[model samples]
Structure formats: C-alpha cells, structure tokens
Target: MKALRHVLRATTVREAIDRVPEAFYERFAFAFLLAWLAAPLLLWWVGPVIGTDITFLAWVNLQVGLGALILVALRLAAHLVPPRDVSWRVVLRDELPLVLLGMFLLLAVLATALSPTAEALDGDWYRRESIWTFAAYVGFFFLASRVVSGVLRRALLAGVIALALITCIVTLVAAISAGWHTDEGAVAHRAIAYFHQFNHYGYLLAVACVLAAAAALTVARRVLRGGLIAVFGILLLTLLLNDTLGAYLAVVAGLAGLVTWLAVLRRLHVTTLLLLAAVAVVVHVLADALGVGVAAEIASLGGDMVAVSEGSADAASAGTGRWGLWMITLEQIAVSPWSGHGIEGIASLLPGGYGRPHDEYLQYAVFFGIPALIAYVSAVVVVLVRVVRRGRAVDGITVCATAAAFAYLISALFGNTMYYTAPLLFLLLGIAWAGVRAAGSELLDAESTPLAEDRTAPTPII
Candidate 1:
C-alpha cells in the first residue's frame, strides 16, 4: 500500500489522468460534467424565476461570463507550462462567419437603441438573445477544446451518462411520489423526469441515446458494451416515458441519419440494414393497429400523439398563440426587408410585450434582416459541404460527428435549438472541426516526411 501510494504520488498529472480510463480529451465530456454539476441549482432556480418573469436568460448569461473567466485562467496556466502549438487562428478560421454575424447583430442592436423608432424596435428578443448565445457557445467551444485532457474527455462522457441515469431515476421517483397525470387523464408517471417540460426532457434523452449508441458501436470490450447497453436502456426508457414528439422524431431522425450515412458510404453491413428496416416496419404496423393514443401510452408513459406534436393546443393557445405571434413577427420583418429593425427592434414590434419568436430563422430575419440570415445559412452550408467531403476519408468518429451535425441542422428547422439546445450543436461542430484538424495534420506529416507512407499506416475508413 505504501509502495502504491509512493507510485501514485510520483505519477505526473497527465499520467495520473491517463490511468483514469476513457478518452479525456473531448470537449463534450467536460461540458457534460459541468452541466451535470450545475443542473440542480439550475432546476431549482430557473422555473421559479421564469414564472415570475425574472428572465432565466440571466442565469445562462452568468454561466457564459464565468466560463470566459475560467478560459482566460486556463490559457494563462497553460502558458506557464510547456507551450503547445495550439492555434487560436485555426479556431477563428472555422468560426469567422459566426463572429461576423454577431458583430452585425451588435451593430444592429446599437443602431436600434439610438434610433427614434427605438420603442418600436423591441420585437427582436430572439435575435439579440440568439446572437449572444451563439457567441457564448463559440467561446465555450474554444475553452473546452483547449482545456480538455484525454482522461477528462472520457470522464465527461461517462459523467454525462451517469448524470442522465440519475436524472431518469429522480424523475421516476418524483412521478411515483406525485402520481401525476396529463390533462387528458393519462398517467404521466415517468414523463416529467427531472425536467419541467416534456420537450426539454426528450431532447436531453435523445442526446444520451445517441452517445450511448456511439459507445455501443465503438467500444470493443464486451464488458464495456454491457455497461453501455444498460445505460442506453435507462436513457431509452426515460425518453419513452417523456412522450415528447419532437424528441421522439429527433431520435428517429438521428438514428436514420446515422444508418443512412453509413449505408451510403458502404460502411454498414447489408444484413444490419435489412434487420433495422424490418424492425421499423413491424413497429409501424404495431403502432397503427394499437391506435395512436394507445400506442403512445404503450411506447411512452405519456399518451396522445396530438399532445406530443409541436405547437400543441396548450402551447399555442397559452402563449398569445404562436401562430398569431409569428404573423406579427413576419409583419415586423416585412417593415425592413433589407436591414429589418435592429436587434432591439423585435420587442418594439410586438403589439403586446411578448419576449421570443420561438423560431430561430424568423427571429434572425426580423432582427438583422436578410443579410444576417444569409450569413448564418452560408456558414451552415460551408460546414455541411466540408463535412461531407472530408468525412468520406476519415474514421467512424468523424462520420458520426458529421451525421450528428445533419440531425441537428434538421431539428433546428422546427425548434430554436441553435444555442438553446444546450451544447449539442457546438459540441458536434467542435468534433467535426477536430476531425478536420486531425486529417490536415496527417496530410502535413505525410508531405514533410519522405518515408511517411512507410512509417504511418493509412487511416482506416469507417
């Protein structure tokens, strides 16, 4: 024991971290760890604050501010140690468009604040918030990329799964204790698991499911596979219990996207594809036969497909009618087609003081005009094109990251998920960028070394 203690004391930080097992270098892992650590406080305060119209947005804003401070501190510490060739320029290269768009919005907000029509320009809450949120995420990505160690990455992943499991368990316990039921008289026994809204819960579960699936595929050891399967089961069960149509659709879409991408690349086995197709068909038939509500109840603790649908009756009717709200938003956007109202102009556009557009694209056009929307779209398109082109030559991890990006892009169309969707978009983008960097490094190494081909084996295709 004394010898073991001496060895542990002698080990370097990196070596000690390496001994922890799992990839500790991934940003998602660290983000997940931080998020989980922060969840209880967030949950306790957010609902109450939002209920009182105190702007829970400030909570996230505070987190972003603190993250910036932490990032600077980490950078300073890194400088004291052996300097690595970490390049902020590379980060800027990938994220320049987002930065430019943010600047445009900032200018717009400033212009609106100073304008004679300043009071009329309050309709751009979504736009202003989204711009700041995007900036915060970009900052988070930079910090996470730099500070994450290999052990921390692995721990983050494991920690995220563990936290998700805990959330599921807590949700289950709460439901059981409360004996809660939906408005339609169906027991929502497991539906609200650790989340106040079904959609949020579903989104979180969907991410867990994807990560769990990735682990199942990539982890070689049987023991690890078994553990991942157990975790996957817990997450899947939580998702079903939540009964969120958007969440359900997103999960289906993500899985389908993953399989379809793999098939197109000829990386997936024909037998597995056939089996999945057969299962899908069987499930569809069963669901149809069971009646929509009954099927929903059986598949998820929540009942009624209609209840799960986006802009459901409760949501649409309760919040000044989203459709009506959107119509007003569109009218505001039409007022200034070129540069629209400034970022602050959105709130002023609303007849009554409504906060958000509930839609990202609409908010963008309303706040910064068509120019900003074009820039945002152009950025997404560039990322997509690069991902597709580079992914073909990379490993499974790269392929998965690309596929996840596609899923997020699709989901973004229906929801204001860009930055509001936690770290999903930023995390995927970071992974995709990391893959690109790795591939570039490999090519540079090959070019510099005459015997590179002999020294390094070809990167195995997914």
Candidate 2:
C-alpha cells in the first residue's frame, strides 16, 4: 500500500527514529538537557496555552517514559558507528566507577527482588525517579563523552548560558505573577512559582545563580558580563526571598567550593574577593530591610552545626517533624541495614506522625542498601577528582561545575534533592570528565614535544 511505502521510506515516526544519525545522540542529549532545565515550567505553561491541566510530576513521569524510548533509539543509532574495542585492563584503569556502578545497580535490582512488597518497586515515587534518572545520566554521559568535538564542546557551554537565561526569564515572569512577595508563612510564593515544591525551587535558584555568576566572570565583554551579573543578582534575590535554609546553605557551599578551588590553584584575585564581599554586604543590607534574617541565621548555623555534631541532633534535622522521621528511618535501617528492605518499603513500617526521611543518603540506604550508597559516593568522588586534577585556571566552568556538584551534595543531606538536580548535575560532570581528559592529554602532548611560542594563536575555547 502507499501508506506502507511511505512508512518503509522512513517517513513515519518509527522509521525516522531508526534512521536517526549517530551524531544526533549528542545533539539530542544537549537539547534534552536544555528542556530538562525548564521542563516543569514548560509543562505548566502548556496548560494555560492549551486549556489542559497537567501536573508537574505527571509530566515528569511522561518524560521518564519518553526517556526510555530515547534510550532505545540511541542504541539503534549507535549501530551506525563501529564500536571501539576496549580491553578489561583499559576499562579497569579508566572506568572503575562505571564498573562499580553496574555492580551497584545489580545489587539494587536484587534487593528490590528480595523485597516482599513487589508493588513498591514501581509505586514508590522516589525509587522510580532515582532509577530512571540514573539510567539516563549514564547513557547521556557515555554518549556525550564519545563526541567531544570542539563544536559540540562549545555548544554545551553556550547551551548552559542559554538555559540559564531562559530560567531567569521564566523566573521573572513567575516572580511578577507572585506580585513580588515572599509570603513567608504561606506555601505559595515567587520562589515556589512553577516548581510548587519550595525547597527544590530554592536550590535550583542557587544553582542557576552560581552558574550565571561563574559564566559572567568568564566573558570578555563587559556589557554582556554585566547583564549576566544582574541576572545572577536576581537569582540571589529570589533565593533570599525563598528563605529556605537548606537552599541558602547549598548556594553558600557551592560558592565556597568555587572560591576554594580557585584559591588552591592560586587563580583567586583580591578584586574578586572584594566584589564578593560587597555583594554579601548588599544582600545583608537588603535582607535586613526586608526583615529576612538570612545572613544572621547563616551565622547562627555555625553554632547549630557544632551542637548537632556533638550528639545534639535537634538542630541536625531541619525540624522536629524531620527529626521524628529520621528516628523512624534509623529503626528501619537497624531492621535491615545491609540490603535495604526496598523502595517504599518504609511507608507502612513507619510510625504514626512520621514520614520518609528528608535526608538523601538515607533514601539511598533505605531503598538500595548500604553498598549502593557507597557506590554512589565513590562515583561522585571519582568524577570530582577527575575533573579537578591539575585543573585549568581560566575555565570558570570547572569551578562552577564543582561548586554546583558540592551544592547538590550538601543540599541532599537535608532533603532528597537528586531527582530535581540529577540531569543538570550529571551533564556538567560529563562535560567536566571530557574536558579534564582533554586537558590532561594536551598537557602530556606539550610535555612530550617542544612547544614553540606563537603569539598569533587563534582564540582557544574555554
């Protein structure tokens, strides 16, 4: 039939998917990375535009299903390029974390199988998000790493800037919609905006702010840099308005990481420090005027943290509710500490007035067990070391990326943040992995050969 002919000609969706170019994987990865940045907001916008009511997490679940389809298409498209032969020795030396990751996943699956409530495997919301996200992260990381051409690498950075800009625009619209108020006691506020979830929006704002700030520092032109700085300032303002202590701590941790990395490399400058100090002063003055004691509260956290570390856990848990939940999680851990009882396994086991622990480490342990938790930490440490080793001084991406990673890491201590930040976090780490490897290779090449000075060098890609 004519219809079958058109389908056979790769005109249909199925055929088109099969015919996707190998290079499209990296491009698609970047595109999806951009979409993921504003997906919730996009979904929310579509409701008004199309006269439909689609909730945020529902949209996310649909995205997860589509992600599975993408994985299949990527696999089929991969057949276009000949596979490289990698020896066990080479893999062990270069990708031990990846190997460990496979083992960890295997353990997790086995743990889930061992769980009595099989329905929890899919019914558990956090479990579903974590697994799908991890799979997508692994697939995208490997795909992106394969095609690190100068153009692709450049696109990634530009894409990040573009994504940040889009975030700022959407955030402004959301803020304006909120009538520019924090509504401190109320749940709905400017910072919550499309994200609805306050803490996720808060930390996301922190990440965006640092990302904008770092990118601003890297630009050569003053006008564009100033604009980015303004955007970063707006993001800070949103964070201040949100007043989520965890998000505040996360952003501060990230900024601290950025400063520490630069300082250790001797790339930190006094002017930069003074500018940062000035920003802090401005933020404090504004917060004081607004009656938001964020700066003072942050100072108080120093003592609070000390108190918690010294066996007083009231301050350690964000609140009494969280403290009660954490106690229940500890009981669950004691019941099955080695291999976890499984995802959503704690729901029924939990006591009255208690809920899931806000802590992410506990989430991993509760669902996938202790070994999987260890594997996750090991993987993070490996990537951080790889990206940061003998680092590049001029590229603010590494510093920003590292800071972002640390922020997510610290933020997760207070809540299950990985679901919200996973894609962006892993994307940066993937780029960092490729960049670090390239930088290391260039260094080796330079050491092996005599490099002649050339003043008329084409401008390098940061």
Candidate 3:
C-alpha cells in the first residue's frame, strides 16, 4: 500500500510539471534569443581550444537544437492552451523556401546513394547535420517573430546592437595597441579580436560599422548618439586597418544603401549627413595621429588589392576550374533533375572532391535539382516582393533591414553566405517582418481609438 501511494505521488508531480502555464513556457523564446546572441561569441572564444569539436558550425547546431527544443515545447503548450488564433500563414509564407530547400537536398542525397563517386566525396557528419541546423534556425526565427511581444522584440534588437558595439570596441583597441607603421615598414602585430580568420574579423567590423551608423541616426538621446559615434569611429578604424576588400566594399555598399533609403523616405536630415561626415573626419584624424605605421599599413592594403586583382585574373585565365565541377554537377543533376543530387549528395559527388561548390546557386542546383531551385527562388522572390511592396514607405527598421538584405544578396553572388549564414539572413528577414507587423498594429490602434472614443462619449436619447 505504501509503494502504491508513492507511485501516485510521483504521477501527481509529473502532472503538475506538464501543466505549467503558457506564460512560463514563453521564457523559452527569451532563452532561444539569448542562445542565438551568444553563439558567435562563444565560437570565437572556445573554438581554438576545442578545435573542430566546437567550431562555428557546431555552435550553430547547438543553438539550433536548443531553439528547436524550445519551439517544440511551446507548440505542445500552445496545443493545451491554444492561442486566440493559431495561424500558419507566417510559417508558410516565411519558411517555404527552407522547406523546399530541404526537400531538394533529400532528393539529391537519395539519387547519389547508388553512385560509386559518393564514397570519394567530402561527406562528413557535421556537414550532414548542418542541414537540420539551418532549418531549425530559420523556423525558430519565423516563429519567434510571430509570438514575441514588441518589448521583447526591441530587447532583441538592443542585444544585437550591443553585441556589435562590443565587437567594434575590441577591434579598435586591438588595432591601437598594435601600433602603426610607415610605407616601407610593417605594422605591429595585432590580436584577431575574437575571430579566427582575418576575413571574418573584417566582416564583423563591417557589420558593426553599419549598425553603429544606424544607431547614430535613429537613437534619440544625445549621450547615446555620441557613444554610438565613438563606436562607429572605432569600427571604421578597425575596417581600414584590416584592409579586407570584401569587408570594405560590403560596408560601403551597405552604408550607401542605408543613406539612400533614408533619403528616399525623407528621413535623412541635414544633421545626419553632417554627423556622418564628422565621424569620417574624426576617424581619419585618429588614424593619422596614431602614426604607428599608418602609411605602411596603407601600402600593405594597396599591395593586397593588387594581389587580389592578380589572383582574379589568374582564375579567369584558368577558366575558374569551377567549370569542370559545374559540368560534373550538371550531369548528376540530369540523372535526377527533379530532385538533383540529394540534400547532402552534391558535396559527395564533386569530381575532384571539393567540399563546397563555393557557389551557393550551384550548390542549390546541384543538390536539390531544377525543381527545388525554382521553388527556392520563388520563395525568396515572394518574400522580397512582399517586403518591398509593404515597405514602399520607409521607417528606421525598414531602412536598416533593406540595406542588410541588399548587402547579403550582393555578397551571396560570390560566397555561399546563405548556406552557412542563414541566421544572419533570417535576422534581417525577421526585422522586415516585424516592421510590417508594427505598421499594421499601429494602424489598427489608430482605427480603434476613434471608435472607442465615440462609444464612450455621452449621448442623449431624445
């Protein structure tokens, strides 16, 4: 009888745990946001120590797994205590591309299963796992945007800005401490500033620069503006010192797009342009003042540019060597043109066994086939069309998001930024979606206010 009573008590506890309120479950959204924010930083710090065990890809997987778990828990709770209206519209609208992409990949993998070449391909456990990671991150962002309150939404934006600012500051300090050099001499060695590759460091600085610039424009407080300007100066300095052409070009294009969008919306005040100019001048003066080898660093950057130009020429002369890979991939696509190679099969079928196609468009076509590529393209086109249609009138968020998307899209032409960097892309997408939602909410509020006022007003029944 005692044992029976204990079993009943255990069952009671389990029931209580399962009955946790939806409000309590909502904390998972915040948890997922925090995990997303911390992932890049953790990878930067611990990656070297742990080697491939904790790579950027691995960190992404962890965040995705946590996000998926939270999403599942939230869905389960929602079923128990349903929302007023559970619309799958946002999921279907925002996530169709990802779903299609996944299907394409699966088909490609299956088609390649019988091929002997698959054994010689660059298949790895991590690469295989990345597809799910990509899907989860995309799904989580879409769901979170739909469910999170405005206050939480702003908090997430603030977190992104704060991270950008911190990264900028670190890069600037590293550059200053390293000191400069003359045209003939080398600059002092500097720390990598939490990134493994120089290109990654440059990319981070470029992004931070844009975020800082946006903050300087939209943030109202004087003190905050000044702080943002200071941070922007530091990030600009870091970018110049790093001298990565891709980073430099991306920032220039992003900032130009932001400024143009703001101007088009009539949101660009004279003071904003003046402040931007002032920041640029201040950065230049600071670089000169350091005198720690500024000229030499400039020369180094020039040399690097020349070398890159030469390399491009060499690649062009060699017919990119990618053409051969492309042909092989096309042949594979012909075998299963509807699905392509399979989700993970393209990488497994490279003629010379290259890990990545290096071209994302090709990667998609090779892995998913023509049908999947068409669906993927259509999905992006739909989102682009929706966002553009709605965002014809500009606002702060729209301007920033539009610029971010433009930069990402342009960069995607050269690198497979979308495949590995889905979070970044989806973050921009979420911002655009949130902006649309906010606009609709404001319109509803405006419309309801007059109705409420009319209903409450004193009326005489004669």
Best-fitting candidate, scored by lDDT: 2
Tens-digit lDDT track of model 2 for 330-359:
878878877887766787766553335778
lDDT of each: 0.51, 0.58, 0.53
What overall lDDT, based on C-alpha atoms, would model 2 receive against the true structure? 0.58
TM-score of model 1 (CA atoms): 0.62
Error of 1 at 210 (Å): 2.7
Off by over 4 Å in 3: 1-26, 42-60, 69-73, 76-129, 178-190, 281-359, 370-381, 392-402, 418-421, 437-462
Judged by whole-model lDDT over C-alpha atoms, candidate 3 comes out at 0.53
Which TM-score value belongs to model 3? 0.67
> What lDDT score is found at residue 201 in candidate 3?
56
Score candidate 1 by lDDT. Answer: 0.51
Q: Is candidate 1 or candidate 2 better by TM-score?
A: 2
Candidate 3's residue-wise lDDT over 63-114, tens digit each?
A: 6556656666555543554344534554454445445545644544544553
What are the clashing pairs of model 2? none
